[model samples]
Target: MNFKVVPFKALTPQQLYTIYHLRVTVFVVEQTCAYQEVDDLDLTAEHLLGVDTDGRLMAYARLMQEPNQQARIGRVLVNPADRGHGYGQLLVQTAIEQIQQLWPETTQIKIQAQHYLDQFYQSFGFKPVSSVYLEDDIPHQDMILTL
Candidate 1:
């Protein structure tokens, strides 16, 4: 899979449409969770799109600088049809690398990860910083990686 890091303003209409589609399909429709998926963050966050050779969006994530002097990665997802391939892994590693490049002085990264993926995030050196809490009725925990 090829990955493209595009800021919100740089994303084309079709790309935006596909991103919203994939995110909704997995986070809402498939998970049966109802909440606001689209938000103000999309306006400032840089987007990571993992696309396949056939030009389909295989995975996606977002990187943004936060007010608390931390870089954040969020809205992470792998396309349902594209799951078993480690695209999520690549997506996250790429997000970290991009954060480093885009904000060199930043030394910490944060994620409000789904609770079930604790081990996965742990593998990347993120440790739980908050107790698991319900967000949109789904369990989530804040994890942080101190770089």
Candidate 2:
């Protein structure tokens, strides 16, 4: 898989479309969630796209700068057909590395992750910082990784 990390303004039209399409595919259509998928935060966040040699977008995530010189990673997804191939893990690990390069002063990274993936994020050094809660009717918990 090849990874590309760029700001919203820098994303090509096709790249932008692919990102949203994949997010909606996994987060909304595939999961059967009906909430709004195109939130306004995308304009200020850096997007990471994981593409295959065949030019298919297999994974994605967005990193946003938060208050107190911290960063947040969200909208993480791996193509349904690509799951179990380690693309999700690769996507996140690459996001963290890119975040560090983009914001060297950042001291921490946060994620509002699906509850079932708590252990997955935990393996990447993220520790739960909030109790389980419902967001968009899906169980989630806030996790943090201090840099």
Candidate 3:
């Protein structure tokens, strides 16, 4: 998979549409979670898009960093059609690298990950900071990866 990190303003209209489409498909419909899919967060976050050779979006996440605050990784998802091919790991690894490069002052990265992915995030050295809790009715755990 090919990876690219783009700021919100740099994303083309079509790419933005595709990103939202996949997020809705996976996070809303596939996961059966109902809540706001598009929020103000998109306006300032750096978006990581992992695409196949054909330019098809395969994975995505939003990266955000603010002064004196830990960077955040959110809205992470692998295209349902493109799962099981390690794109999830690729997408996440790329997101982490991007954060480290773009915000060297950041001391950590935070994620509100689905409960099922707790171990997966742990594999990346993300320690659970909160016990399992419901977010939008889906079990989630807050995790932090210290840089």
Candidate 4:
């Protein structure tokens, strides 16, 4: 699969549509969660898109620089048809690399990961930093990857 990562403003309209559709497909329609997916974060955060050779959005994530001087990664979503293809890992690693480049002095990366995927995030050096909490009716925990 061909893959590339770009910032939010750099995303083409087609890519934006595909990313939104994929997020709604898995986050709301499939998971039955109804929270607003298009939050204000996208305006300033770095967006990463993982597309296939056929130009399908396989996975996506966002990186944000917080006021507390920490780099954050969130909104991780993998297309249902693309799960188990290691696309999630690739998406996240790409975001982390981009964040590192964007903020070289940043030493920690934070994420509010779904509870069930704790081990998956751990594989990327993210450790549980908070007790599991409910967000948008789903269990989530704050995890951090310290660089």
Candidate 5:
């Protein structure tokens, strides 16, 4: 499971491709979500990618800080075969570190997480801040991790 988590700007073309392919495989094909994955945020985001020993992308997510004083963590995805490997948890921890590095004064990390995974994110210190709502036809809730 040799992996490296690099910022979005530091990602190579191949790395970006591996990420999108994995996202499409899991989010689109597996979850049946037909929405667009590339929402124009990647250009300014700091991506945390988990590449396996063979250079395959096992997991990925992005981090961005908006004007509302909220640092966002989104676009979380893990390859189907890679589930239960703890890569997603590592990706999140790395993303949080990136946010802290970029905005040390920031107090909260926000995420619109899928409803069923609320407890999973909670284990990492995230607290639900919004009533559950549907996003892309899937139930989701807004969660925030306060630093």
Candidate 6:
């Protein structure tokens, strides 16, 4: 898979459409959660897309720089048909490297991850920083990775 890290303004129309479509398909439809998927945050995010050889988006996430200079990774997802292929790990590892390149001053990365995936993110050095809480009816916890 090829990874591309682009600012919101730099994404092409088709890329932007595909990102939202995939997010809704998995986060909303597949997960059966009914909540707003496209929030105002996307306007300021740097999107990371992992595209396959066929030019289809198989994995994605958004990187955001917080006011305190910490980086946040959010909206992580792998295509339903493409799960169990290790694309998700590659997508996030690429995002971490890209965020460091984009913001060398950043010393910490944060994520609001689903409770069940705590171990997965933990493998990337993220430690739980908050108790599990319900967000949009799904349990999630805040995690941080100090660089």
Q: Residue 114 CA error for candidate 3 (Å)?
A: 0.6
**Sliding window of 10 residues with minimal summed lDDT for model 5:** 1-10
Regions of model 3 farther than 4 Å from truth: none
Angstrom error at residue 60, model 6: 0.3
Model 3 over residues 84-113: C-alpha lDDT tens digits? 988888888899999989898889899999
Cα deviation at 69, candidate 6, in Å, is 2.1
* Clash count (model 1, backbone only): 0
Model 1 clash pairs are none
Q: Give TM-scores for every candidate, taking all chains together and pairing residue i with residue i.
A: 0.96, 0.96, 0.97, 0.91, 0.90, 0.97
Candidate 2 runs further than 4 Å off: none
| lDDT, residue 8, model 6 | 90
The digit string of per-residue lDDT tens for model 5 on 1-41 reads 54455667788898888888877888888889999887689
* Clashing residue pair totals per candidate (backbone < 3 A): 0, 0, 0, 0, 0, 0
Mark the regions of model 1 whose C-alpha exceeds 4 Å error after superposition. Answer: none
Model 4 scores worst on lDDT over the 10 consecutive residues at 1-10
In the range 57-107, model 1's lDDT, one tens digit per residue, is 999998999866689999999999988988888889999999999888888
TM-score of 1: 0.96
Worst 10 residues of 6 by lDDT: 85-94
Model 2 lDDT tens row, 43-118:
9999988888987998899999998989999999989988998888898899999999999999999999999999
Pairs that collide, model 2: none
